[model samples]
Target chain A: MAEVTFDKVRKAFGSAVAVRELDLAIRSGEFVSLLGPSGCGKTTTLRMLAGLETPTSGAISIDGTVVNELAPAKRDIAMVFQSYALYPHMSVAQNIAYPLKKRGVSRADRDVRVAAVAATLQLGALLDRKPRQLSGGQQQRVALGRALVRDPRVFLLDEPLSNLDAKLRAHMRAELIELHRRIGKTMVYVTHDQLEAMTMSDRIAVMHDGVLQQFGTPKEVYETPANLFVASFIGSPGMNLVKGELRAAGSGLAFVRGDLSLPVANGGTAGAAVTLGVRPEDITLGAGPFACTIRVVEPTGHETIVMAEAAGETLVARAAPDSQLVPGQVVPFAVRAQRLHAFDADGRRLPLVFAQSNGA
Target chain B: MRNRSLTSRILLNVLAWSIVFVIAFPLVWMILTSVKPQFELFRIPPTILPQEVTFEHYHRVLVETPFLKYFRNSVILAVGTTVLVIVIATLGAHSLVRFSYPGRERLAQLVLFTYLLPSVVLIIPLYLLMVWLGIANTLFSLMLAYTTFALPFALWLLRSFMQGIPQDLEAAALVDGASRMEAFVDVILPQAVPGIISTALFTFILAWNEYLYALVLVNTDEARPLTTGVMNMLITAFNIEWSLLMAASVMMSLPVIIVFALLQKHLTRGFGAGGVKG
Candidate 1:
C-alpha cells in the first residue's frame, strides 16, 4: 500500500487549464474518489497519477518518492480504464497475466497467479475466452482481474462501472468495496456519478470546471458543503437554493424576495443579498406557514419528488409516497430551520447564527 | 414494409449479375485469350472459345523466355516495396497519431500533401538521385522508387486507422508495466492487423502494376518487373506473341488474387471493438 500526494499539480493544454492548483493527499489504503461532471479534469488528475499525463507544474509522490519524472511502467501502479481496455487479441488469462509477464515472471508462476485471480473474480471458466466473447459485466471483471493480479502500489479506476447497466453497476460497486476491504490497497477512483462516489469513497474530492470545490469525507461534504456548487451538487434531488435579500424585520432580519418572505436569523448588513438553501429531505410536507403550489409530483414507490414553485424559482422537495401530493395543488411546507444553509452573493456558504422568529 | 415482389427480385438479380459480368468480362476475355492459339486472337469476330485450347503459350512463358526470371524480379521488388512501405508508414503514422511535438500537424499534413503530388513530377529528381547513387537500372532503384510513391498513401490510411484505436488501450498497457514500445508492438500493432494487411496489399499492387518508374529506372531483364517485362516482350519478340503476352498479364495478377484470398479472413474478423463497447 502506498499514499499518493499531489503537490499543487497543474495541467494545461494551450491556454486551457484542465487542472490547476490540485493539492491532495491520499492516505495509504484509503479509497478516495475524484468526483465531478464531464470535463472537470478528474480524469486528467488520475492520468497524471498514472503517469500517462505529465503535470505542467508541481510534483506528485507515491510512498514519499516524487514520481513526476517516472514513466508509467516504472511507477508501480495499475489502472482500469473506463472502456475496460482488455487486450482484444489475448485470452482472459493472458490479459490478467500481462503485468506478470511484463515483469519477467516464469510461465508456470504466471499461469498459477492468473488462475488464482480468475478464481477470486469467478472467471475460471472464462480464462480462455476472448474479451469480445464476454458480457459487459464479465469484461469488466476481467479488467478488474487484470489490475488486481498485479498487486501494484496503487490502484486507479476511471469510471469502471459507468459502462455497465444500472443493476450491474450496483453489483460491481459492492464487489469493488469488498475487494478494497480485502486487499486494503490505496485506490483512487474517478467518476462523474456522485452516488458511486458517496457510497464507495472514504473521501470525495468534488470538482467543478477543473478546480477542486471541496475535499472531505462523504458525510462531511453532504452535511456541510464548502460552496454553493458543492451544496447543490452533493444531494440527490439537489439542495433548493432561493436567492433573496436579507432585510430588517420587526425583531430580526428576514429573507425577502418578490412575494415570498421568510424570517431568517442573520447578522449580515441589511439589504445584503443571500441565498437560502435546504435539502429536500429536510423539508416537511404539512401544517407550516410557508406554502407553494406543487408543479409536479413523481412517486417512485418509496418516496415522492414534489417540485414546487415559490417566488418564480423552482424548488424540489421530497415527501412520502403516501402523502397524496399532486400537481397544481398548494401545500404547506416547512424547512428544518437548523438544517438550512445560507450563502452569500459570491456563492460561498455563510456561517450565520439563526435568531428564532417566534413562529412569525 | 412488405418485401419486393418476385419479378422485382428477379429483375434486381439480373441487374446485379449484369454489373458483375460487365466488370469481370475483361479479365475473363484475357484468361480465354491466354489459352488460345496465336492466330485465333486476330480471327474475325475473335472466337469466344478457342477451337483448340493449347498450353503452348504457358509453356513458352515458363520455359522459352526470361519470363520466370522477370517474375522473380517483380516478386522481389513488390514484396520489398510493400515491406518497406508498411514498416515506415506504420511507425510514422503511429507517431503522428499518438504524439505531439514540434511540427506534428505540419508533418502529418505534409505526408498527405506528398501523396497528392503525381509520381511523374517526382520521377525526374528521383532518377537523378538514383544515378548519383550509382544504383540506376537496378531492382533496388525500382523498389526504392515504389516505396517513396506508396509511403504517403500508406501512411495516411494507417494514421486514420491508428487514430480510431482508443488511447486508453496503450495507457492501460503502460500502467500494466509494459513500456511504450512494448505496448505498441503487443497491443496496438495486433489491433491494426487488418489495416496493415490492406496497406501491404495496396503497396504490393501499386509496385507490381507500376510502369513508369520500372521503365525509367531499369533497362535489363535482370531488374525489369512484370509491367516493363510485358512491354519488353511486345517490343522484342518481333512475332508479336499475343497469347504469351496475355498469359504473362494473367500470371502477374494471380499473386494479388491469392494474397487477398489468404488475408481476407482477417479483413472480416470485425476487430472485436478492442474491448471498447462503442
Candidate 2:
C-alpha cells in the first residue's frame, strides 16, 4: 500500500559505479519492473529498495517517509531472490510461517495463517516436506507463499522465474500476474527478461549502463522506444536498425541507402547520418516498392520471422506462418509509413511527421 | 565396461583394506598388549594374543593410581576448551563472512596466519601469561592455553565453511522481520551445524592429546590431562608397567573414537544445496 520513490539514487562499489543518478517513482499498488541486461544496475536498484544496499547518495522514501537509514527488517518489504533461498532446515509450513513467527505471532495463529497460505498456493499436502524434497515449481510457490504470508508493504522479486523450465515459467508468469491483481502490493521486479517485464509490469523501466533509458507502459516502451537501445531491446527479434541517411525526395523525405529507399515521416538534417528503426511486424512482405533477398525463414508454429537483406543490411520481419518464405528469394518489402522511427547519428529519436502512402 | 569396472572395484577394495589394516594394527596391538600378562608382553617377538588375560593392570589403574582423577581433569579441560573455542570461532567466522568493516579481510587472514605458527613457539608466552594471571598448575591454565592454541584453526575452518552458506538465507530472514542477530541464531547458526560439530571435534582432540602445555603448565595429577599423566607413568625409575601404560592409552583414546563415530554422519551430510538454484 506504499508508493516507493527513489530520488537521485546512486550506488557504487569502489568507484566502479553499479547504479547512478536513478530517479524513479513507483505508484502505490503498481507493478513496476527494472528490466535490463546483467550488470545494468537493475538488481542494485532493487537491493536499494529492499534495504539490502544503501544508496551511496540521495534519499529513498516509502509512502512519504524517508528510509535512508532504515534496516531491511524495519522496512516492511518482502523479496523473492533469484534463488528462492528457502530455509533448508525448515519444513514447507515452517518456511511459510517464518515471517509471521518473526513478527511474534503465536503458534496457533501461525499455523492457521500458514495453512491458509499453503492452501492458496495448493501446497497443503506438502506442509511437512523439506524444501529439497519439493519440485522446482513447488519450491517457487513456497517462496511466493513466504512473501505473500507477510503481506508486506512492497514485494520485490529478482528474476524469480529465470530458473524454471519454459512451460513452468509461462505458467508462473500468469500466476504472478493474478497474484499481483489479487494482492495489489507495490511490486518492483528486477529481471533481464523483457518479456517478463512487458507481460507483468504496469510500467517497465528499461535500463542500460546503470541509467534508466525509458520508463513507461509496455505498449509505450515497445511502440515508442526512447532511443536506439530501447528500440532494439524491447521487442522479440528486436527492432531492425539500419544506418543510412535521410534525403529530401519529391514532396516528402525518404530514407536512402544503396538499393532501397523507404518513405518515412521524417525530420532530420539533409544527408546527415541517421539510423532507421522499425518493428518486424510493421513491415509488409510480398508487395512493396523495394525488393529484398530472403536469407532465413523461421516459422515458429504461429508466426514467421523472415530475415531479408536489402541495401546490404538484413532486416527481420514477422509475417504469417504460411507465408512460405524461402532463402535466396527476392521479395517486395514496404514498411508502414507512420511506423518508422528515425534516430540521428547520436542515437536520439527524431520526431516523425506522417507522409503520404507511396506504396499499395 | 562392466568387466573392467568390476576389476577396478576389486583393486580398490584390496587397496582400501590393506591401508585400513596398516593403520589399525597399532591400536589392535595396544589393546592386545593391555590385556596381556607381563610375561607374555616381554616374550620373544611378543605374543600376538594374550596367553592369559589379567585384570591386574586395570585394577591398579583404577585403585592404585590417580587415573580416574586425571581422566576427569582431561574431560573438563577438553570439553571446556572445545565449548569455548566453538562459541568464539563461530561468532568470529560469522562476522568475518557477513560483515564488511575496516581491516576485516586483514583480520581474517590473521586467523589463518596465527594457526600457521608452531605451538612450541607460543608456549613460552602462553606459560608466562598463565603465571601472570596466577593460575599456573591449575586446570584453568591448561584449558585457557588449549583454547588459545585451537581457536585460530577452529576460526579458519569454520570461516571457510560459513562462507559457503549463501547470504540470501540471512537476507530472507531480515526481510521476514527478524533482526540480524535473530537471523543468525535462527537461520545461519542452524545451517552451520556441521561446521560447529567439526570445529568442536578438532579442538577437543587437540586439547585431549595435548602433552607439552599440559606437562609444562600442570605438575600435580589433580590438573593433568591423560597425555601428561600417562607420560608420567613412563618416567618412573622402576620397572615400566607396559600393560598399565597401554591400558591408560586405550582408555584415553576411547572417548575421542566414540565422539568421532557418533558425529561422523553429520560431517559428510550434504546440506550444501540450501535449496537455491545457483
Candidate 3:
C-alpha cells in the first residue's frame, strides 16, 4: 500500500477545464471518497490518478515517487469500473487472471491466486461462467474479483455500485466497507451518492463545477460545512436556508423576510445580509416560536419529509414518520438554536459560536 | 370467438402459402427446365416435373465452354477481393471510430461520399487507366476495381459495428495491461463478429455476381467469372443452348443463396434493431 499525492493538478480539454487546480493527499491504508454530481470532475480526478487520463499540468506521486509518466499497470493500481467491464467472451477465472498473466506470473501461480480470490468472493462455482451468464450482482462480484487478484498498491472504484439495483447497492456498499477493512489498502472511491460517501469513507472530498469545495471526514463536512454547496449537497432533506437581512432582535438577533421573521439565538455583526440553515431534524414541529404552512408530506418509513413555505421561501423538514402530519396543514416549528448554521451573503459558513454543538 | 378465429386463421395460412408458391414459381420452373429432357421441355403445356431428369446439360456446360476455368477464376477473384476489402475497411473504420485525429470527422464524411459515388461515372476513366498500366484484361485489374468500389460500403458497415462496442471496454482493457491495438483486437473485435460476418457476405455476393467490370476487363474465358461465362453461352447458330444456360444459372445462384441463408439472423438484427448506434 502507498500514499497518493496530487500537487496542483489542472486538466483541461481544449478550453473547458475538467479539473481546476487541485491538490489532495491520501495517506496509506486510508479510504478517501471523491463525491460530486456529474460534470463536477470527480471522475476526471479519479481517472487522472489512475493514469487513464493525463492532467494538463500537475505532479502526481504514489509511494513517494512522482508517477505522472507511469501507466496504470506500471503504477500497480487496480480499477473497478461502474459498468463492471468484464470481458464478455472470457470466463470469470480468465478475467481475474488477466493482470497476473500480463505480469508473467506462472500459470500455476496465477490459477492458485485466482482460485483464492474467487473463494474470498464466494465465486468458486462462478469461475467457469461467462459475464453474460451471470446476473447483475454476480457480475459485480466478478468485477471486484478481477481487481482483487492483483493486490495492487491502490484500488480505484468509479461508482462501482451505481449499476446495481437499490437493495443490491446498499448490500454491496457494506460489503465494500468490510473488504476494505480486511485488505486495508489505500482505496479511492468516486461517487455522487452522498449516502455512500457518508457510510464508507474515512475522508470525503466534495467537488462542484470542477472545484474542490471541501475535504473532511463525513461528520466534519456534515456539521461544519465550509460553504453553501457542501452544506446542501451532503444531506438528504438538505439544510433549510432562510434568506433575510440580519438585525438585532431581543437579546440576540433575527432574520426578517416578507411577513416572516425568524429569531436567531446568537447575534452577529449589526445589520448585514445572511442566510440561516437548519437541518430538517433540527426543526421542531409544534407550536413553539415559528409557524409555516405544510405544502407536502413525504413518508419514507423511518422519517417523513415535510415541505413547508416559511418566510416566503420553500424549506424541507425531516420529522418522525409516525408524526400525524398532512399536506395543506400549517404548523409551528422552532429551530434548535444550537443547531442553526449561519452563512454570509457569499455563502461562506459563519464561524460557529455554539462550539459545543452535538455535530462536532 | 376462439372457434371462429381458429378456422379463419387456417384459411389465411393456406392463402399465404399459395401466395408464396406463386411468387416462387419462376425460380422453381427455371431449376426444373435446366434438368428436364429436351423431349419433355416446352411440351404443349409445359411439364410440372420432368418425366426424365438428365445431367446432360451439366456435363456439356462443364466440358465444352471453359466453364471450369471460369469458375476457378471467379472464386479466386471474389475471395481475394472480399478478404482484402474487409481487412482494409476494418482497420480504416476502427481508426475513424476510436481516435481523435485532426479533420477526423471530415475524413469520415469523405469516405462515405466515396462509398456512395457512382461506379458508372468512374468506369471510363478507370478502364483507360487500366489499359495504360497494361493490365486491361487481367483478373488483377478486375479484383482491384471491385474492391475499390466495395471498400467504402464495407468500411461504413464495420464502423457501425465498431461504434457499438462500448468505449469503456477499450479503456478497461488498456487499464488492465493492453496496448491500444491489443485492446481493439482482444476486446472490440470479438463483439463485432456478427456485423463483420454480415458485411463480408454482402461484399462477397456483390463481387461474385458482378458483370459490368468482368465484361469490360476480361476478353478471355481464362479470366471471366460465372456471370459473363453464362452470358457467353448465347450464340445465333447454337440457339443460346437454353438448357445449359439454365444449368449454369442455377450454379451461379447457389453461393449467394447459401451465404444469405447462413447470415440471415445477423442481417435481420443488423438492419432491424441492433445497428451501430443502437
Candidate 4:
C-alpha cells in the first residue's frame, strides 16, 4: 500500500481544462472517493493517479516518489473500468492470470494465484467460462480478480458499480467495503453517486467544474458542507437553499426575503445578501415560525419527502412516511437554527453561531 | 392449413435450389468437361455427360506440360503475399485504431483510396518499378506487386475489425501491468483472429488469380505462375487443347476451394463480428 498525492495538478486538453489546481493527499490504506457529476474531472484525476493520463502541470507522487513520467505498467497501480472490460477471448481463469503472465510468472505460481483470487470472488465454478458467457456481476468479479491478482500498491476504480442493477449495486457496494477492509489497500474510487461516496469512503473529495469543493469525512461534508455547491449537491433531495438578506433582529440577525423572515444566529453584516440552507430532514413539519403551502409529496417507503412553497421559494422537507400532507395545504414548519447553514453572495460558507433549536 | 404450409415450404426449397444450381452450374460443367473424351466436344449438340470418362487430359497436363512448375510458383506467390500483407496490415490497423498521431485519420482514408484504385491502372508503373529494381522475373517481385493492392485492402478491413474491440480491454490490460505491445499481443490479437483469417484468405485469392502483372513482368517459364503458364499452353499448342485447359483450371481451383472449406467458419464469423459489436 502507498500514500498518493496530487500536488497542484492541472490537466488541459487543447485549452479546455479538465482538472485545475487540484491538490489531494490520500493516506496509505485509506479508501477515498473523488465525487462529482459528469465532466467534473473526477475520472481524469483518477486516471492521472493511475498514470493513464499526464497532468499538464504539477506533480503526482506515490509514496514520496514522483510518477509523472512513469508508464502505467511501471506505476504498480491497478484499475477497474466502469465497463468491467473483461477480455472476451480469455476464460475467467486466464483473465485473472493475464497480469502474472505478462510479468513472466511461472505457470504453477499463476495457477495457484488465480485459484486464490477466483475463490475469493466465488468464481471457481466459472473459471473455464469466457467473459461473454458470464453474467454482468460475474464479469465485474473477474475484472476485480484481475486487478487483485497483481497486489498493486493502489486500486483505482472508475464508477465500477454504475452498470449493475440497484440491488446488485448495493450488494457489491457492501462487498467492496468488506474487500477494502480485508486488503487494507489505498483505493481511490471515482463516482458521481454521492451515496456510494458517503457509504464507503473514509474521506470524500467533492468536486465541481474542475474545482475541489470539499474534502472531509462523510458526516463532516454532510453536516458542514464547505460551500453552497457541496451543501446543495451532497444530499438526496439536496439541501433547500433560499436567497435572502441578513438584517438586525434584537441581538442576532434575521434572514429576510419578502414575507419570509427567520432569526439566524450568524456573524454576517446586516443587509448583506446570503443564502440559507437547511437539510430536508432538519425541517420539521406542522409547527414553527414559517408558514408554507404544500406543492408535492413523494413518499419513498422509508420516509416522505415534502415539497412546499414558502415566500415564492420551494423548500423540500422530509416527514413521516404516513404523513397526511397534500398540495395547497398551508403548514407551519421550523428550520433547525443550529443545524442551518448560511452562504454569502459568492456561495462561500459563512460562520453560523449555534443557538437554541428554533423548533416549536 | 398443414397441407398448404407443406406446399409453400416445398416451393421455397425449389426456388432456393434453383438459385444454387444456377450459381454452381459452371463449376459442375468444368469438372465434367475435364473428364470427357476430347472428341465429345464437337458432337453435333454437345453432350452434357461424356459417353466414356477419360483421365487422359489430367495425365497429360500433370506429366506432359510445365503445369507442376507453375503450380509451385503460384503457391509460393499467394502464400508469401498473404503472410507479408497480414503481418504489415495487422500492425498498421492496430496503430490506426488505437493511436492518435497527426494525420492518422487521413492516412486511413488514403489506405482505402488506394484499395479503391483499379489494379489495371497500376500495372504499367509497377512493371517499370520492378524492372528498375532488377527483380522483374522472380516470385519475390510478384509478391511485392501483390502487396501493393493486398496491403491496403487488408489494412482497411482489419482496421474496422480492430475498432470493434472495446478500448477498455486494452486499458484494463495496461493497468493490469501489461505494456502496450504486450496488451496488443494478449488482448487485441486474439480478439482479431477471425478477422485476420478472413483477410488472409482474401489476400491469397487476390494473389492467386492475378494475371496481368505476371504476364507483363515475367517472361521466363522459370517464374511463370499458373495463370500465365496455362495461357501459354493454349497459345503455344498446335491444336486448341480445351480438355487439357479445363483439367488445369480444375487443378488450379482446388487449393482455393480447400482453403475456403477449412476457414469457412471463421470467414462467416468475421463478416458478422467485424461489422458489428466485438
The estimated TM-scores of all candidates read 0.91, 0.93, 0.86, 0.94
Q: In model 3, what lDDT does residue B93 have? A: 83
Predictions' DockQ, in order? 0.80, 0.81, 0.45, 0.73
Name model 2 segments beyond 4 Å from true.
Answer: A250-253, A262-266, A357-360, B1-23, B37-48, B268-278
TM-score, model 2, chain B versus true chain B: 0.90
- Give all candidates' CA lDDT scores: 0.89, 0.88, 0.85, 0.91
**Regions of model 1 farther than 4 Å from truth:** A249-267, A293-295, A309-313, A326-332, B1-53, B264-278
Report the CA-based lDDT of candidate 3 relative to the real structure.
0.85
In candidate 2, position A309 carries an lDDT of 93
Residue B74 lDDT in model 3? 87
lDDT of 2 at B51: 85
Report model 3's chain A TM-score. Answer: 0.94
Higher-lDDT candidate of 1 and 4: 4
lDDT of 4 by residue, A155-189 (tens): 99999999899999999999999999999999999
For residue B54, model 3's alpha carbon misses the true position, in angstroms, by 2.0
TM-score, ranked from best to worst: 4, 2, 1, 3
